[model samples]
Target: MISRAEKSANYLILVVFAVFAITPILTVLQAAFGPSDAGGGGGFGNFADAWRIGHFGTYLRMSLAVSVSVVVVSVLLSILSGFAFGVMRFRGSGPLFYLFLLGIMMPSEAIVVPLYFDLRSLGLTDTFWAVALPQVAQSVAFGTFWMRAYFRSSSRALVEAARLDGASTRRLLWQILVPLARPAIVTMTVLVFMWTWNEFLIPLVMVTDENLRTAPLGLAFFQGQYTQGFTLLAAGAVIVATPVVVLYLFLQRHFIAGMLEGAVRE
Candidate 1:
């Protein structure tokens, strides 16, 4: 148990960190809605201008497509692979899982140059699949690792009980285990969404098509536009960030619960 003084210190530290985290967002909001000079406008005006100038509508839609595809495919594969690794033991399973560990350990920068050439050789460059497929692979690698740990730590007694009741493997996984793993699943989904949404290098390297540009890439280009000012830039940042922020808030309870659960398990 924590002492009163320790609890107070913890609260103080949390407050400090909270303020630190919020400060930049508050500053960006101020700049985003700040008064404009010359012929420009403030508040919604900057956002509107930024949206139009940045072509973020198209960029965001493309990003949404990639993110959704990556999340869905990767998380599903993660669940299946994780279940196999965590719940069942088989020959060479340890080495194969360790091979996946390489994916998590190796940075994209190391493989990206070769990957781009490989994709080009396969004639997949400048396409939606080009931008999304690599990310899917990367996300799956991490997601597998993540979900495997969750399943491994899950209540084996419950699993045994389900088995004794004549549950099929499919029923056991989808009906019994998956429901209980909601918080963990949601946590992984949130993480993958954030990662896929923010991925720059993959999309940048794979697609040169303007229509395939992701939000971050678009923002980078938007910032380069000479006519755009600081307010507009800030507004663009806010726009790009809003979806992930909303997602995290919507899944906040589950995400936090998963984090705490992982901590306890660790």
Candidate 2:
């Protein structure tokens, strides 16, 4: 239990951080709904103009397509790989596992130039696949590491019992491992969704077609033109931020529990 002073400090910290974090969002909100004329009163006209000019409905669809697909694929693959590496023992496991650990340490910016050429060779450049593939790869490294840690500390007796019941490898994972590992899975899903949704640099470099641009890319363009469009930009920011906020709200407990499990295991 927190003391009164500690609670007060916590609120103070929350307030300060909220202001700091919300300053840009507020600016965008103002631009989105702010005054239309040079020095006129605030109104909803800017949001209307931005909506029409940005083709935001289409961009929202593109963002949903890319982000949802990336999250699903990334979560499924990470669970499979993390469980294999965490629970199963085989030849060359140590070395291969460390290779993945190395990938977690590597920064996306480091190989982005090569990634560009690699995508170009595959003829996926400027497509949703180009962005999705790299983002998935980037997420897998850390997701594997984190999920692996969670699986490592999970109940061994349950795994053994499942094996005794004649469960196959795939069934054990899907039926037993995943159910027990729900907290970690939810945490990884939230984190990956946030990253893939807000990602800008990769999409900025990979996608040239305006129609295929994700929300972040569209916001960048909107900001460039509507330099003073605070209210409209705020509305856009709200739109872009809504999904992740809702995800965190739903998964907050799972996220915290997963983090605690990893910390204890490590």
Candidate 3:
């Protein structure tokens, strides 16, 4: 049904957008591998130098710990809440679910000031919980929305069958529904992990200790100190971004499937 002109136009549009998106990344790659004034090194050597000079080893560990913690806590809470909202209706459930959606609509920047003051009051400033807790809350909002869509559209026959088999609510969820929700859960996990890993505003405001600095936060300070060192800056950017890239690559299939399913169902 499509004309050759339409196909060509589509390809052309895609090519243009691809170049637009890739240009900055390619520029960074070039800067990372190109010669620098700090030293004669290029390529991987630049990464090593950046890693050493930036203390990214500590940053990487801190980021992983915070991100992983956020993902685990957020995903679990989202799943439980999603199951409740989607399958087990109760009093005032609609209002409560809407409250959760408000979280998704709220901007982090809007809350950063209040969040910092609250954390300071609790004496959680400069601590891992300071970064992880807010991110967990944000991620759970989206995850609940995502998983609730999945559960709402899931097979009612299977749920009824589980009930007839005398499966308790917790057992039914974990032993039956959880396995079938793998694609959706994996997709949610990947997304939450990415968000938590890339989050900057919360970590920047909450923690001041160098040892607790996440990769992105550390990269910001590293850029400040090495403003003239383009090669090192580029290399540090690559280092900070690589884990997210690798994670997406590994989980792309599930993520795509889950997204398509969510789209069709919604």
Candidate 4:
């Protein structure tokens, strides 16, 4: 049914967009491997030098810790709360759901100053919890909204059949519907992981200790203090971005399937 001309046009558009998307990354890679501004080594040697000087090993581990903690806590809480709001009807539920939405609506910039003071008063600043807790809160807000939508759009006949088979609410949610919602869950997980991994501001405002600094924040300090050249800086950027890229690639199929399923469902 499709004409060859239209198909060719679509391919042309995709090729153009792909090139546009890939050019910057290719440029970064070239710079990352090019000569150092200090007039010395190049190639993968720059990455080695940058890694040694930047302390990326420490920063990356801290980032991994923060991102993992945020993702796990956010996903768990979001599932529980989303199930409650989506599948169960209760008093004041409407108002409570809106309260959760406030998290998505609110910008971190609006509250970071006061949030810092609150965490400091609680003696949580300059610690791992300080960097992670805020991000967890932010992720949970969006996660709940995302999970709630998936659960609400779920198959009612399947849920009814599960209930009739004597499945408890928890079992129905965890065992039945949750498995069917894999794509949606994976999509949300990828999003939360990416956001938490790339988050810079909360960590910056919450912690001052060098050990507590995450990769992005560390990259900033790495740029300012240790590096005076473009090569090392580019290499550091590549190092910081690698984890997120690897993660997306690992989950690419499920992530894209989920996004497409959601689009078709809506």
Instruction: Write one digit per residue (lDDT tens) for candidate 1, span 158-222.
Output: 88999999999999999999999887888888878888898888888888888999999998878
Please give the distance, in angstroms, between residue 194's alpha carbon in candidate 1 and its true position after superposition: 0.5
For model 4, the superposed segments whose C-alpha errors exceed 4 Å read 1-17, 253-266
Candidate 4 C-alpha lDDT tens digits along 1-266: 89999999999999999999999998888899888775658988888888888888889999999998998899899898888888888999888888888888788898899989998999989999888888888878887888889889999888899889999998999999889887777788887788888888899999899988899999999888975778888899999999888977898875566556433211
Task: Please state every model's RMSD to the true fold in angstroms.
Answer: 3.5, 3.8, 2.8, 3.3
In model 1, the worst 10-residue window by lDDT is 257-266
Clashes of each: 0, 15, 0, 0
Clashing pairs in 4: none
Q: TM-score of every model?
A: 0.87, 0.83, 0.91, 0.88
Better of 1 and 3 by lDDT: 3
The true-versus-predicted C-alpha distance at residue 194 of model 2, in Å, is 0.5
lDDT of 4: 0.85
Q: Which candidate achieves the best TM-score against the true structure?
A: 3
Worst-scoring 10-residue span by lDDT in model 2: 257-266
Instruction: Give model 2 RMSD, 1 decimal.
Output: 3.8
- Overlapping backbone residue pairs in candidate 4 total 0
TM-score rank, highest first?
3, 4, 1, 2
For model 3, the stretches where C-alpha displacement exceeds 4 angstroms are 1-12, 253-266
Candidate 2 residue-wise lDDT, 1-266, digit = tens: 78999999999999999999989767765665656643434466555555676678778888889888988998888898898888899899788878877776676687778888988998989988988988888777777888788788888888899899999999999988898887677777777777788888888988889999998899888778776535666666767777777877888775566546432211
